[model samples]
Target: MWYNQFRKIQKAGDLMGMTVNKELPLPADLKSEEPLTADIIALKQKRDREIRDIFTGASDKFAVIVGPCSADNEDSVCEYVSRLAKLNDSVSDRLVLIPRIYTNKPRTTGAGYKGMLHQPEPDKAPDLLAGIIAIRRMHIRAIKESGLTAADEMLYPENRSYLDDILSYEAIGARSVENQQHRLTASGMDIPAGMKNPTSGDFSVMLNSVTAAQSSHNFIYRGQDVTTDGNPLAHVILRGGVDKYGTCIPNYHYEDLMRLLAQYQKRELNNPAAVIDTNHSNSDKQFKEQLRIVSEVLHSRAYNSELKKLIKGVMIESYIEEGCQPIGSNRVYGKSITDPCLGWEDTRRLILKIAEEA
Candidate 1:
């Protein structure tokens, strides 16, 4: 009966998917091609430890994950990270700066420039095999130029092993937070994994995801069954949320922070923390509002001792130039091709201010 039903669907052409365009080398093979030296791996391990300390409340410095919204060009991304390396020294005592080298961007409609992982060149057609190699090279170069290991989104859970040795922090985006695979992958991560609240922005949903990530689980992964001991560093990132009407609902306010804190108290989460994304729905996509949002969050933290302890950091979108440009022949250099970002001048000033107060 089952075979007849399957034959019915198959014969009707319903039991099919898009054919595989090409077969690429496995992640291990790619890592071998563009390998990280033993020294680099050791340095990454140390960096990972320091980052873990900050999220676990062992370090008092506030973390700022700031950089371009999407890393499109290799030279430009490396150059931007180089600048951050210089600034890292200036605020090392008060802040731990983690540059965002997000290579895989999530598109709402499953179209447009997916990111460097899809189209290594923004305007060109996608070449996944070339894209895979391009992204790995860029990450390696960025770390070598600047002694800073950075952050990237685990946009595709299976694509993670490709950059596992490089990324210091992993973010589960607003759209993928409530997913089972994403939550499971976070548990097995050795680095900090920040899970953003879903687009609908239900606190219970976000908290539940966090709980799941921090608890042990036995699940199937990549053609094999695996058991995870859970990731204690898995936490929440409040990027604000959107309602059914597509209106952005801001959740980084003090009242909202208080509410989250109350919720955290009721749970047995480890190293309970939250990182506020100053852009996204929190700023309602008004890129310029990120500065004000960061200031307000810092103000709220200073006003409340509990908030100061629970809210560990922020995520800011910034680049060499402010605003964004569409992908075309006359695209501006260093400006975002995806989401609008804060220009360099304002980003520098904001970090200095944060260090002074935070």
Candidate 2:
């Protein structure tokens, strides 16, 4: 059905002036998921188990998925992960650290840098074929070097298979969380997928997306009919929401968490959990505020035992350097080319503090 729908759109575009440019390689053709080195495989297995255990209430460790907003430079990202790899050992008992390696970024107005999956080189034109290969290679390198199975956003559901084998956790971004394809794809993945609240800030839409992802469905995926067994690990990610006045309002407070708990109870979904995105609308894109926001969330958890169980972890956007830079300017090493992110020093401090608090 998806192929047929694409054909119909193509036919209509042909009548206009649009034409098919090229056909890319299938996932299998691009890169086979040959087993990784035994050590890396063991690391992934352990990380995956810990994450699932946290969601299922079998563990009390806080999960922190932190890294660059978009992985623009491979070297800088790998360096960041190396730091996280070392830090993970220190806090392993209290926190599960999964570095965020978001390759595909959804632009709000369909403009700006679309992430490494589109442009491996920020200053060059998009070579999707090369972009595909670059992303896969980068993910492989991160895991091989850092011994960490990173988290990435499923910006394009169809493209997820390219790195699915390496990703320990997946997030359906605010813009894509409401889309049917994204939700369906999450239902089939073995890794935990966090469905973020939509831009509209509607809790029902977020919960409904979780419900869809946690239920079985038959759908057209990659030119094939596929059925999913329903992902019980599908959970919610409150990244805050934008109000009608075009303002970013927070949803990470005690009241907000209590409200989410109420909603989850009403639904009675499997492995109920929430991952609070400290940046985005919650911090109103003010990167520095992430420290305060995370500190407050931990305080809320300390205040309420139930909130601690429901709030599984937090998502943080941090890079080697502080804040963000424009796309074509002199790119700062480890600084974000997309969203402004918390700098490395503050990020390190915050993680240690979170571990201490947790």
Candidate 3:
């Protein structure tokens, strides 16, 4: 291996002095194309209103965001969304259901699907173009069939045009919230947005993101000069942090959130509310703990007046079935294959419990 490495190094020097590698042809200029339609806008507006009503206390409904940790299979994804849509109507009055259509998955070590964007290969086929096509097709079909609005974590700004028409809500993940490009994208985004805090769970970073996303800003959008309306609905999501951990077993630490809410009100921010991500640090990335955290939050609302108004929604990483399997494996149907998740039975019971309490 050492001898091969030396031989490869010599070849790299020779190649560097040889003909240069030309830029690959750019994909068709789909970036300049507009895809969002009237019907899509109408659905988006309706869902936006529902979210607003929930946060503003004009409605008694609780917001529930549930779906796969990351979307991969088009056929299976559509089927799952369709099922969620039916469930949405059944709980329509009491809950606002938002189907999570995330296509990007950021890894701590930079390995994983990265969504269907970087790897179309479910079975070792490296076709990124095919991956993009498959994901876009799945997103459109889900919107058309599910009659449900979708939410995505906006990662690649250039990829926005692909799903702009289909997405209703966008989230800036913990790692990306502090990024200027993401903040700019959030400002220009037409849909309501949520910004999560830094991985350490600092509210100030989230507050800054909220301010950036909610204020009008000038930025380039698809080779055109553009200004955004600035998504006022942008809010904070407290998934908890190790800093707030009990230094032992996992706990939601309601006091941590109460302090955050007071800070929001003190800053005179919009609505003074926060969405508790029932996954991640709040549950210590243990999927089953999601249910307990959510139940505790919902049930504790009675004594926590501040929480009653501030906790408008809960984000759960769930799918058609429970728990996760290894990526790219031919595993059980409906298993996450990404992050471990609360199984269907437990998820259903938790949702019903939250609804009953709400």
Top-lDDT structure, candidate number: 1
- Clashing pairs in model 2? none
- Model 3, 1-358: lDDT tens digits are 9979966766565555663323222334442343446786687778777777776678768888888888867777788888778777667778888888788888778866587665655556556566666676677778788878888888877676677766777778888989987898788776667888777777888899998988888878666688887776788887765555443223356677667776887785655667778888777777888877887778766678777887778899888788778865666777776788776667677777776787
Clashing pairs in model 1, backbone N/Cα/C closer than 3 A: none
The CA lDDT at 221 in model 3 is: 68
Q: Note the Cα lDDT for every prediction shown.
A: 0.93, 0.91, 0.74
Clashes of each: 0, 0, 1
Please give the ranking of all candidate structures by TM-score, highest first, separated by commas.
1, 2, 3
What are the TM-scores, per candidate, against the unseen true structure?
Answer: 0.95, 0.94, 0.85
Of the two candidates 1 and 2, the one with more favorable TM-score, higher being better, is 1
Pick the TM-score winner: 1
Candidate 2 vs 3: which has more TM-score = 2
| Tens-digit lDDT string for candidate 1 (239-263) | 9999999999999999999999999
User: How many angstroms is residue 198 displaced in model 3 relative to the true structure, after the best TM-score fit?
Assistant: 0.9
Q: What tens-digit string does per-residue lDDT give for candidate 2 at 1-358?
A: 9989977787664636766555678888776544456787788888899888998899999999999999998899999999999999899999999999999988889988898888999999888888888898888899988888999999999999888777899999899988999999999988899999999888899999999999999999998999999999999999999999999989999999999999999996999999999999999999999999999999999999999999999999999999899877677789899899988899999999999997
